[model samples]
Target chain A: MVPQEHPLEQLLRSDRMPHIWCPGCGLGTDLGCYLRALSGMDLDKVAFVSGIGCSGRAAGYVAVDSFHVTHGRGIPFAIGLKVANPELTVTVWGGDGDIFAIGGNHFIHAARRNIELNVICINNAIYGMTGGQVAPSTPLRAKTTTTPYGNYEHPFNFSYMAAASGATYVARWTTAHTKELTKSMREALEWKGFSFIEVISMCPTTFGRRNGFADGLEMLKDMKARSEVKNFPDLEDTDIGEKIVVGKFVEKEKRSYLEEVKQWR
Target chain B: MSMKSWQNQRGFLFLKEERCKGCGFCIDLCPKKVLRQSEVMNAKGYHPPELYDVEGCIMCDICTEICPDFAIYRYRSKERGKNA
Candidate 1:
């Protein structure tokens, strides 16, 4: 028998049930947080754009005006959408690899330009969609399909990078911190000019199993134990290692790209 | 309280067993310890969670918050002023 629609069904493409995400993958949780963040807001005014990855699939599931853009192109698409229709709330959602690897240049330049865009980067620390490859955000000594022996390179601290690149708002949260993540998402949506939120998610099928966590739950518990909520800290101290520092790292007012363009006219 | 009496409570928890992938996030995060992993596997070969102690559930909705698959959620009765 078909079950009754869930309360959050209105915000979801219900026909896309049983999403392709694995049993314990945190992308679903992240999507839930994003939807919860959109609660009480004007859903019609929202345009969600996502790049190719596990996180990118969220565009298909969300019952909003959404676009499943090409790899590492979510930000550019969002930028175009926002510029064309400044009234719409534009958000770019994609994985760490999509945002920080192939899209890394776009990410920083958008932040540098202080564009009026909400960017949600789901950091699973690996390229989960394309078979667990070593990503720019992959932590050192972590095993991925490509980094079989262990990742020896340092990873980018996304919150710090966002702040450094001139994002008006920046925050970091893990999947286990649902309430905080939801709050951050809401705040990011409300903020203008390159709001970047780095969500530390788990890919049990790839990053988690390749590392040590047996599944998503174990990874979440580990995150819970290692996470410390501090309002702000030095960018150098924001590295993800044995302990992860999570919180609102930066929130400032600035002239957004749209506003600046209007002034130039 | 009796099972029948508990059924009159303002809040109820539902588990869409068929949709559950048995990740156990709901069970692990339930503050009241009201759920458990059922031995019975669903069509997906996953052990869907079951309510073990409904009386303890205060309808905090933590399970709903933590469920990655959206397979679990809480429903509050429209009857006003009753304990949730």
Candidate 2:
């Protein structure tokens, strides 16, 4: 019963109305923004690639030409797609464990090379599909299947890592705020250099149940209330690395790797 | 195809059911009242949105935009026009 003029009217599959994601999970909001971004841009020449995990299945949900790649190899496949077809707008999709953990090396090197591709990292903090195990992004002291006694390790700040690794575009947002997430995704897709969007998702069934949250919606509300916009005036020494800043962290015009390769002629 | 013309003729939307608590968030959000509660239940036993009239649906997918669960999709065909 949706109207045809709405931006998101075309990308969905009616037969697949009810998705497989758990109730109160944040993946829906993240997916909605991602699709809105895709719909807003020119996608006739776009190709989506995904790695193993719940986020990996994103390719199958949308209407774009998608490639389901091997576990921890989505970015590499997207890189190859861009290299072979420079005109194609390639986007890589994966989870925190797949990108920032198991495929951590590839993630850094890709940014270091300034690969001209969009990487959507869905950070749920824990490995949802693999039985709620603690991920590299799992906060310290957070309980998980592997860390039932509480994790002693610190979680990785994905946007910071991308910025430090030479990516041309880096941004962070949570699923609770869809408008900002969609806006950032749209910009990242238009960037000519490597673009990374880190989305803090909710694995309610696992992360919530283990962390003592009543449900995923509670976690989402917490994330919404706890996140702050990054502003220069808001900077405080004590706030450094203590508060989560959500916004466009970095974006600049740079020589894209694919463009540089083409110029070699 | 001209970029502007192609864009004008083609459109799409996505529905994310994971966020849906099946509380009918989009059902109340749509201005046109295009969406309705479905009798069929999904694997999760939540009744998803069901389109009452396919032709009446203008492909607005506003249902998707306002849905708290992110459940509702719309798509328009470029090569085939708006028939199917």
Top model number, lDDT: 1
Listed in order, each prediction's TM-score against the native is 0.94, 0.78
Candidate 2: where are CA atoms >4 Å away?
A1-9, A231-242, B1-43, B47-63, B66-69, B72-84
As a whole number from 0 to 100, the lDDT of residue B61 in candidate 2 is 48
**Candidate 1 local distance difference test against the native:** 0.87
Off by over 4 Å in 1: A1-4, B1-8, B78-84
Report the C-alpha lDDT of model 1 over A1-265, residue by residue, as the tens digit: 3224566878988778778999999999899999999989998999999999899899999998999999999999898999999999998999998999999999999999999899999999988878989999999999988879998999988888889899989999999999999999999898878899999989999888878889999999999999999997787898999999999999988999999999988
Per-residue lDDT of candidate 1, residues B4-82 (tens digit): 1122264667767777899999898887787789888877899988887777777776888888888888776644565
DockQ of 2: 0.14
Where does candidate 1 chain B have its weakest 10-residue lDDT segment?
B1-10
| Per-residue error (Å), model 1, residue A117 | 0.5
Q: Listing candidates in order, what is each one's chain A TM-score?
A: 0.97, 0.92
Per-residue lDDT of model 2, residues B1-59, tens digit only? 00101122344434443334565546654566756776765556777666564445555
